[model samples]
Target: MPAFAQDSDSETSNNTMKNTEYVTFYPSYGYQDEGLWRIPLRVWVHKHGGWGGKQLSKVAKRVVRNKAGLEELHQDQIEMFRFRFRDFVADSQSFEAIFLRFDQDPDEEVFRLQSADGDKRTNFNGLLFGELTLTFERAEELLTAQQSKNGWLRFTATGKDHQGEGAVRLIKPQGDSVISDIDDTVKITEITEGEAVVMMNTFFKPFQAVPQMKALYQTFDENVALHYVSGGPWQMYRPLADFLFKTAGFPPGSMHMKNVRLHLLEGETYGDFYRLIKLGSVASEQQKIRQISEIFSHFPQRGFTLIGDSGEHDPEVFAHIRNQFPEQVNAIIIRDVVNDATKNPERLQGMKVIQADSAFIDADG
Candidate 1:
């Protein structure tokens, strides 16, 4: 018999809530206490507002009004369109609580979460986002659950009329780990190529992995855990996971990302839309620092190899992180994206720099 079996089967198949959608995300494992493993549960509940031409037209018109402001307006339209329609569908439904359960385990249990506590779940401030990140306590039994060879354990989440599957990677406190950046380092999103290109590559184009990076990641033995820390908002987690782990064949690990919510703009100006994008860009550096610091602090006994690209503030951020946790951070690798003849020695003063084109052979030799 499974634990919490009653709660797992409690939600009935009611007619009114049949259209709900649940998107389960990669959850992070917390520290172990007296035989219990701490697992942070994350789930998104919304209405499936399918991608339709009418929705696109409505959003585009609200964003782009005249040709005089076409360029900036196009950028805003792209942002609104990508967020408002694809993947992230701001639901009209309001949920005060939800339930989650581990899959493929004989003793799997269901956990209930409330929305009153802002950090544990999305309060009124994040109601528009529908992202609930609640922590599960005394969950040590989960460690015995079946896990993929790379340490990922599967789980199912359900709320009202929605249901979905997600996984969490269990890592020990003491081990070698790799903390990689998603953007220019592993996946190719040209940050230095301006907003239009960034939006195009992120939303429209197929995601491409940096050549050799996947192979480099696979070289790590079982004792070495993996993690992906990025400035990209949590909304992009599903697509990014599919591209990196499923398609590119990189090992699965914990995902740490910025909490950003995008809602359909009602009577909002172009300046308002543009400002949100700008704020996210500026906050990227700080977000990475905070997330990486948390990971380092979470596993104080684990040594980390930080990987990022030179197209942005990665070099500076990694350098700062190393300064804070000099003992735990074993290496800081900056992938050279900026084309400087001298390898930009001053910019990459303290880190090991690699060229994307030759990183494989370079790392192997």
Candidate 2:
């Protein structure tokens, strides 16, 4: 959609190059409409270093050979092209610049500069990386290419020190709706409480839902936008984003959470303060409820569903949303936590409250 420069010419010239080449790969068609195909391409840049320094000598591309290959691409593939960098010496300063051009179109060119570690361990930048450009073509060509010889598409790119080539495919979008929690939703393992203090520091994987959630996530990802609201601090946005994209099966979308600095307090300790100030005061949960209300208020035509666990205030918060925004909320599903569904009779009355094991099935129904 937009143009990106991979590296600066100065940076490229500074590095010593034992070899420099460009490789192109086949293109992957992601989405097709009105004869236009959204193609995905993966390009890799490799470099070798000299006494002066390490430098990129070649760039390579990976193409999808089958539909199953599409799974290798991450969510960012929907909008951006990404690659992983591997094999570098420890503390060595070596980088590679990649320039991508599609079909001799100057305006479609994209660029990126990737650095490598000196160790052989192969470190990746972000789990996702890449650039996207629009291409105009008939969908028939894409479908035919898949079935015909040489019909499959490919990607070609030139690099300062290297080149790459590969195949491409048309990918279909996942249309699913996601209902998620915010606090332990994507960050620390547990909710923000006294126990969470130890849990957070225990080096446990972030609080992302287990892989079992993927089935439920896929159910709505193909059709509905993910709605993530949390009682946790909003500062965890970046980690949350990574968690959703990498661990949990949430597509890119907006996240809602409390302003901890403005709402949550210190001196009382995280746990005591949260329970005393957060649940004790309706302001925190109210903030989330109001956000949901605003969402339904603006998009009344779209179906809205509520997903939360009984661990914290999700039950009450979701119930409030259901009561206030009945027409917009298709269903409310709460994952049981404390086994005290009756604690909040007002929140449970007439609403669907299922155990975690059953919530997904009931939500699908």
Candidate 3:
């Protein structure tokens, strides 16, 4: 997910509509075997009742920078962040209704769901998001056989108020999956750059990727499954997925991104173990450790090669998985984001995880 907010499936068109509505299937990945496979689908609703331009306050006009302004790049990034914040403040809302439709057929023919959980649906801005657990049995086998650019099948989610689509990528029982981070690994998110990271995300600017990382990914792209795991919010799922294909030239696979949840977001700040918690809500900011562990657990027979960066807790998280399921994880590649990458060259030398700087990617990775 570049810009990390760039979502190919999450957002609606840029609009000044008085009332905006949208739906999305976060993660864009699911799993099925020989039985009834249930995929969790979340539907986000945005209802706004004012001009889009009115969403931003007067202060933002002075804050958001012009293209040729001083410290242009940095200012643009800050402006992007402010733009997102303004959107969050203005259009972001919690809502629900009885007629939340999830179907794969364009004409509502092959697959459809009329009602979900008795229809007493509702949503909240932060904690109470709406969700539906889609179930399937023998039909799953038929779906597994179907093919498209992204995954096994494409699903359409339509509410009386809004409609959207997402790819339901499946996890196979007997195959290889390469699960890796997007930011700072495959793409140049510049996480360490702090506030300056937003510029690459705004206004259709071309986002960059890590050198040779694409080639490294392409090496396995032919005969393996690619799962993108990232810290980017699911709100940007659409453009993010789009960029992965057209810009990065990576094969289509399932996406696992952040869900904006207060506890999970604040846990890191409060030094709490919220990242370890993994139940209850259908949509919430799932900590990477718990989410990645779930993926490993989902396909015990499948071997996974974890790739992430030293920019955050990816090294620690991937290392933990490697230690726990050393056999399932084929390799752990950690790309250095900090300057002093060689401070402890001897550390983790005996393990399968390889920590190399960006310069050595194509040559070593």
Candidate 4:
């Protein structure tokens, strides 16, 4: 995996340290491979100037007005926007490595994260906007030092003078599992309602869980592992994570989301930032397929229940994955966001489709 750094890494490290910064350890999963434990550890490092000033809000409103729609944003919407957008406009940090402490005391042995391809330090694209994500391959004996009875472990990480904590869920080589989509399946995004509506729901409105969706997930016993794979960008991780595991009462699980980056753009204007959001947030079918396939390859003896929404390409993507791993995929459930799945059979030909207002869904076939 490539390294992640901010666009302004050329600036002095002292200057970067003076600025208010934050770090996020995205939830990841661990697996045993060839007598070793490996974690696809993902971390994001950046600086936030805080939301006390409206300068950031003004810029964000301009971007939303130009990109989301011509409608004027309410005061509440602007406040909501600032909460998530605070991390988006911040500068990413360039660090040689991050320190990791496993499920031991603070004085225990700490490990450093590094790439499998022999890059001693992490690399980051100096983009003007968007979140910076660092994914490292760590195959170490530290994890195996302590066995977990519940098949999960917790770890605290510190890097670039920022402190954050994350957890990893380990699945057995053979068991039943559920791979789910985030946007319209469990959370309401109104994706089929067009770009403006999608933006409003994503940035402006309060996040609401699909009726009884949390209860549906609760039905899965501790034996069945959970994975949330979404087309959303990693920048949305904080809000989404809280909404899922905290506010909405859904089970905690490993997350896999699209990387956030706008390449070489300066991102100084509203238009540029709008393009960053529009261009970078779109879902890549191949990306979803490849991510799910990696999970399947990791646990060939496991059975999976694929759950997604009909708003986008979940049906097609799930169908493709089912075809590729016929023995592993036991069922496919598609939440009908458009409310026309039965009318258009071809769209979800062989998959199971439920109504938009479905109060419950069965993952067990």
Candidate 5:
């Protein structure tokens, strides 16, 4: 939720700017507990392969875009990109420490710095990693949920070679929050079509949101916090957020996306295609389990409705979450993208699993 809490749903901004230089921050969202406000902000710095890779890429692009030529060009470009991107983790340095400042009410005021406090140093050991935390002991603005469940904090991150400024949101618990998946459930990725579909969706095509998702979410009153939790890589977090707010009229909340591992690739361009084969793997299954369960753990008392598609193991993963947090998980909603496993039912255990063709259909059940 880029704009914070909107209407009645949770508005946590999963914002990231795509740039060749400096660090990129994932869509940062936080919930206030009691008087404490915490934001798990993640940032990554890009030193780039710098001018060498840039010039080389330019030269390579001029050589023609054939498969053989493109592959070689990508290899060179990746090597160069990785080279400068590794200086932060060299043997000489244990970790690079970066300073940060937080302003509760960012304005030209008298007690500006006093209103907010994030004057601390965060140690970064990885080029692309979740670093630092903004902890506020007395978050009065955020604590006043009676007035409004949302508040904003302007923050600045500074290092020798990097500097960035952005706003972190605070959403105090209202009531039930919906944790939804992006791929097939909320958007049409054509998972049933496999590799060709993945390639088309990931690269050459415009992302399409599922029908009636915006109007469907609005049916629930303004207080239902809506969080989007997806296995999509952090690399595309911004694009996903853009689609949520701009393309679809759904209000934002906490958006949690998985980090991209360098090893999770088949090819620079065709890596996404491998997801078809990896769909039901034990590894991917466990990942989905951890991703969604951890969220349930964090907000133990908040009622949640788990939403995902049958394309992957969202059903099983959500099933595990229902078992793990029996009291917290309200219901498991799985969109039938593939087989109607719900007829006989898969491994749903004793939880209430609802299978539907669309999220808008039979959503009340």
Candidate 6:
């Protein structure tokens, strides 16, 4: 059994515990205990590396069945910790200590912890290699300590090969589904001629969704899964993720984009094949439709709605979906762009196509 240790110095002791241990804790404001709010303390452990250089013990900790389930972590009432490793130490260090405080109101169940309480302290004797002594008042006192007691202590540490650390917080949205677009959808004002090519080179400027679109997004974020499928390069994934969460208020979800390179070369180069198949511009869109179909097929209980502007091939792609899976598609809302909306009259005859403003009004109603 590995041992844990806590900081010994009184000055550092009052501060957050930054030491080599099995578990560390951090204070979370949103999560509460017995009326006291607390933070999550990520924990790390050492394990054997398995096949393909994968760490086997870390994998075991993430396994659902054993003792690693997210629910199990909450149920076991285990203190949360953050894991870290150091090149010199050759062991992991867990920082912070978190506990749950319960609320008296049965109807309003709440949990909290006093992370800043000066009274809280831990000790490292070196004998208990990976053991820790975390002392705190009962759950009810957590909030009181937060107000009257010393502020919570937080610590940072360096690590070599820290494992079994960090807790997973499950974020459950209330809305049913999230619908979005690609190209100029979250990127800058591109996806169209004239200004499209110019906007491509100008980076750093944030690519945000229109305000009205965000307002619409607030309507169905809780239950539905959000998806962003674009005809852009897969390299845009990270930047797009940041833009969506930071600027556009779009939650992370399944994102499909062009393969760029397929299993087998269709021509001299992948770009050649992409242009030959007219896929360079709409590859992600096709992949997105297939993904939507797959998701709807598996989850029949949830209804899906598609949203996009008619600037690009959205009309053609969405039309294909309506023809193929009319039953699965509850509604198709397309924002009119130029005269494309009028041109697709044949496709919009049966499906639902409305201007952006009109859709917002209907959503508000």
**Predictions in order: lDDT:** 0.61, 0.42, 0.52, 0.66, 0.52, 0.39
C-alpha lDDT of candidate 4 relative to the true structure: 0.66
Which candidate do you rate higher for TM-score, 3 or 5? 3
Better of 5 and 6 by TM-score: 5
TM-score versus the correct structure, for each prediction: 0.76, 0.46, 0.69, 0.80, 0.67, 0.45
Question: In candidate 3, what are the lDDT values of residues 225-261, reduced to their tens digit?
Answer: 7777776655445556656776678767667666443
List runs of model 5 lying over 4 Å from the truth: 1-21, 31-35, 47-137, 141-149, 152-167, 261-273, 276-280, 341-360
The positional error of residue 323 in candidate 1, measured at the CA in angstroms, is 0.7
Query: Cα deviation of 236 in candidate 6 (Å)?
Result: 0.3
Per-residue C-alpha lDDT of model 4 across residues 1-365, encoded as one tens digit per residue: 10112122222245545553444567766666675456676666665553432465566557665556756877887778877565566566664366667655434757666555644344562111121122222322333544544456666655445555667766667889899999878898777666677677778889989876667788888778889988777767787887788778777787877665533233544333333333323346677888899988988999999999877778888989988999899888888877656677787877777778766664442
Which segments of candidate 1 are over 4 A away from where they belong?
Answer: 1-18, 33-35, 50-85, 114-122, 125-150, 261-280, 340-343
Cα deviation at 69, candidate 1, in Å, is 13
lDDT of 2: 0.42
Q: How many angstroms is residue 161 displaced in model 5 relative to the true structure, after the best TM-score fit? A: 6.6
| Model 1 / residue 285 / CA error / Å | 1.0
The numbered model that scores best in lDDT is 4
Q: For model 4, give the 10-residue run with minimal summed lDDT.
A: 1-10
Q: Which window of ten consecutive residues has the lowest lDDT sum in model 1?
A: 1-10
lDDT of 6: 0.39
Model 6 per-residue lDDT tens digits across residues 228-316: 65665442343455456555665444454443332121333323322422332455557667865654544445456777766666767
